[model samples]
Target: MGKPFTVSRETIVLAPPEAVRGLLDDFHAWRAWSPWEDLDPDMERTYSGPDSGVGARYAWDGNKRAGRGTMELTGVQPHRVDVAVAFEKPFPSRSRVEFVLTPQEGETHVEWFMRGELGLVQQAFALVKPMDELMGPDLERGLANLKAQAETEAGSVA
Candidate 1:
């Protein structure tokens, strides 16, 4: 056991909340924007439960870099999505991830948040490379990719 921690990143996507939510609500659509999607080109993935929204599940196992993890969509609303994530390899940890979308003008403000308790191993690792240092870039990149994809799709539909 270790201390609790939170890491968050936000970006403005030039699209409506619904558009951004579409990409987030479906695990399959994550391939278009998820930062870790390319970590291991041959990563094995499985999807179960509903196609999207609450109850949807996505599991992945890959090379050392990709590790192994599972994500379940625990809750979904018009402007927010909550996911339960568990990593079993490379580390063993569980986190609550949230995506909050707020409409501003015609665009959407997207905030990605992750909060969890670090394991003893992770706490030690944090001393060398903090959680923010490790996850901030990935969060930023994912949000940037999400913004680009959402804007492109929104523009095409306009």
Candidate 2:
């Protein structure tokens, strides 16, 4: 095992914190903003446990880039949602994902954070592209897409 990787990304969205939190609370809502959703057009997805909140779970098996993994929401807060992620195929690993929301005046500040130990395969890949370099773009893209979707959802409600 190599040094663990920690990647955190923050984005200001033109929506309420609760609204942004809602987006993270539901796995189904992720299809609208999750960066990996498009990685495999034929990805098989399964939703189990609660519909949303702490117990919500999502699993997917997809193409090479998509791989296979399962994520379960383990904690929930008015402004934070924590997820436990585990990969079974392509690589077997685990990670802790946290989404924090903060309301500013009228807009919401959103931060997506992930931390995990590097598996042997990941350690090798990290040599080619550091974790931040590899996952940062995806996180940024996901946040950007989330911002657009949250703002759009906010607009529709108004």
Question: What would the per-residue lDDT of candidate 1 be over residues 30-122, giving only the tens digit for each residue?
Answer: 999999999999999999999999999999999999999999999999999999999999888999999999999998999999999998889
RMSD in Å for all candidates: 1.5, 1.7
Number of clashing residue pairs in every model?
0, 0
lDDT at 9, model 1: 99
Top-lDDT candidate index: 1
lDDT, each prediction: 0.95, 0.93
Q: Extract clashing residue pairs from model 1.
A: none
The TM-score, computed over Cα atoms with residue i paired to residue i, of candidate 2 is 0.95
Q: Which residue runs of candidate 1 sit more than 4 Å off their true CA positions?
A: 156-158
By summed lDDT, which 10 consecutive residues of candidate 1 come out lowest? 149-158
